[model samples]
Target: MSALPRLSTIFLAAITTLVAVLLYSPLFVPIVSSFFTISHGNVDWSSPTLSTYVTLAENHDILAALRTTLIVGVCTVILSVVSGTLLALYYHGRRSGRSILQFIIFLPFLMPPIISGLALLIFFREIGLERSLLTVVIGHTVFVLAIVYRTVLMRLQSMSRTLVEASYDLGATGWQTFWRIILPNLSSAMVGGAILAFALSFDETMITILVTGTQSTLPVRLWAMMRLGFSPDINALVALILMFTVLLCVLAARFLIPRQVATERT
Candidate 1:
């Protein structure tokens, strides 16, 4: 009986290992290609070089697109964080037509990206708004607003009502309470949400492609280039972006996890 149980446990462990390998193999293919040469379904075992990195530096068009992407990402992060936080505060406990409005706020994120992209494209045309980086920023803010709002609201709800009540009980004015207590407590969540929003904006391509005018973001540019096959430098850029995204995720987790654990303990 003991031998049978051990054999079954070993079989389950082997199956789990096989599943993990299957899931990560697709990711491994790209990371491997970024550094080493692959030909005819085989990696060259000779050596690796930084030639791709050098080539990426000279690719001014792609570099320009990357700059544009960064600008849009920053703008999206700022707008979404500010607006989402304000909206969350405004609607936290109030129920006056807010449920429907909140639903509208979340609709863009809940809908498919293609649908949201098309809707925004049409809306911009109706409003005579030129399809530019500004339009892209608007699209990204709308798409990511839900994430920021949800993050901030979760933090706000987790906060002790006693903290705010104590502020008032201690003779602090409304602005004083907000500035000293509420804002400070919510700051970490806002920062984490901003990072998440920026990361999403950096990689956003579907809505951006529809709403973009002359300037395209990095993901859009990559999509265009991918149709004609990727160059070596593009691989280098992908490697860098993957690393940056991982860093952002780490930073976001660092901020979000502690707040969540504290909330749970409280």
Candidate 2:
């Protein structure tokens, strides 16, 4: 029995390590290549330099796409957070058609990105809305809305009802209780949801490709560039984006985990 357990542990550890390497190796390559020069399909490891990053700064096309991506991401985050919070608040503890409304809100997110993008594209065309950054923003917001709504709704569900009752008992008005007792409790979840929405918007490619007119976001631009072979600056850009994504993930985890733990305890 002891030998069997030891063998299973070793097998699981090996499988975990293999999976980790497979998942991260592609990301690691760009980060490593960002600091070194690749010569005729070989990396020159002798001299590392920051020239690629400098070149990335000077790449106007890439920078423009990056700017568009940021704009879209910010818009998506703002729209999704506000709309999602409102929807969550409206549907919370409501039994009338709540399940159907929740399903509708989540439909886009649950669909494959390509399918969702295609559906949005068709809808826009039917409505005579031209492809543009606004369309991209709208698509991203629809896709990420469920995430924000679910986050806020979970937080609300976890929150103790006594907080609101106590506020009312203390002679606080409805608006006052919401502003003080509710909003304060929900702030962390909202922040975390915003971070997640931004991250998803930043990385979104298929929908952006379908919805964008003259301007493309970073992921779409990178996809176009891949056919021509990647410039060193592209590698640098990927590395920077990976770092930014990691930071956002860390921030989201920080904001969300403590509240969840506290909720579980209470």
Candidate 3:
């Protein structure tokens, strides 16, 4: 709060702003080009059009890839949520090996994507699994499992043990306690995890590229198209995706923010 400290804080804020601008500069180029004409590696400032959006609608291949990405995202969310919640429940307490196994569960996420993808690719080939959407789903699930598991586990850890005890003292069976008491508390965390998982799966490119077959996700498709130069439609698609991602983040925060915060504010 002192003057010198305040100046230091201002300098730090300025540095952070510059870093953010540097990071977003590349994204601005595509978005800017989407609205205007580009000629000879430069944007034609006088011309502005929505032709790219029209082109995007007509591009069936990209649309198909987009569909594939959505499908994979949904599948990944479902699988990761189920498995992660189960793992959290199973390993919540009473085990010496659980920590080691949890580390193993998280290894794929901690390791580089190329390494994880290569390992999975080889594992699949050895197990006779084909290169396809199914493989992509599995890869995505593995990659996202750590996030889902961590989120659910944190919620579980934060929940008061007395709640479970009180439920049982009221003559609730184990199943009843889990279904009525535990699941309700976990619902928000599960939803938040699902959103995070879906977002990661939606944009996952490295593992998808390695494990995918003929059906490509949007990111992989975009990567291939970039080699041939992107049209205006790609920028339109990027803009739409950015908007959607922001919306998803807002929804996720809504779900994940603790109810106690709302109570306090009110």
lDDT of 2 by residue, 52-72 (tens): 999988889989999999999
Q: Each model's C-alpha lDDT?
A: 0.89, 0.92, 0.90
Worst 10 residues of 3 by lDDT: 256-265
TM-score of 1: 0.91
lDDT of 1 at 131: 96
The predicted structure with the larger TM-score, 2 or 3, is: 2
| Model with the higher TM-score, candidate 1 or 2 | 2
Model 2: weakest 10-residue lDDT segment is: 255-264
lDDT of 3 by residue, 1-266 (tens): 56578879999899999999999888777777788766777878897898888888889998999999999999999999999999988889647788787998899999999999999999999999999999999999999999999999988998889999999999999999999999999999999989989988998999999999999999998888888985667788888777678788788777787677458568
TM per candidate comes to 0.91, 0.94, 0.93
Output the number of the TM-score-best candidate: 2
Full candidate order by lDDT, most accurate first: 2, 3, 1
Estimate candidate 1's alpha-carbon lDDT, on a 0 to 1 scale: 0.89
| Backbone clash tally (model 1) | 0
